[model samples]
Target: MLDFSFGAVAMGHLVACVFFLKFWSRTRDELFAVFAAAFALFALEQVLIAWAGLPKEEQTWFYLLRLLAFLLIIAAVLRKNRRWS
Candidate 1:
């Protein structure tokens, strides 16, 4: 059940990444490009988790990868917001 869920989540992330890429292609928006990259990292993390069989005990580096993805999102938002300036 857990393995199935991980696979589903990974696939979902990949789909999102593709969609973001399409959006970036149409609009040429750097935000969408960054989002696609972040989602790709998310997919990679999910695949690693599933393949490594460490659902509960992910290593520090994996968590860092997740952190980087989230940070990418936050950075994008901040960069886009005028109030942050």
Candidate 2:
């Protein structure tokens, strides 16, 4: 169901944020901050997506948020990889 996907993504993003924060604390690296920002956006995107009662026009912004958030996550990962190597 759509509800399930939204919930799952929200939860997953939360978990990822927590994990990244822990890693950040241990490593004291700035890369984690990038991930944190990305995950935070991801959480926002999911919240917007879940509000099914919203107008179609509003939902369009949510979709854009989701796309940008998704790209940020990927950019964070790539940046982290480069930092590590």
lDDT winner: 1
Provide the lowest-lDDT 10-residue window in model 2: 47-56
Candidates' C-alpha lDDT: 0.88, 0.79
lDDT of 1 by residue, 1-85 (tens): 9879989998999999999999999999888999999999999998888788764755556777789999999998888885557
* Candidate 2: C-alpha lDDT: 0.79
The residue-level lDDT of candidate 1 at 61 comes to 67
Predicted model with the maximum TM-score: 1
Model 2 spans with C-alpha error above 4 angstroms: 55-58, 67-85
The residue pairs found clashing in candidate 1 are none
How many steric clashes does model 2 contain? 0
Give the lDDT of residue 48 in candidate 2: 69
TM-score of 2: 0.67
- The runs of at least 3 residues in candidate 1 whose Cα sits more than 4 Å from the true structure, single-residue gaps closed, are 58-60, 82-85
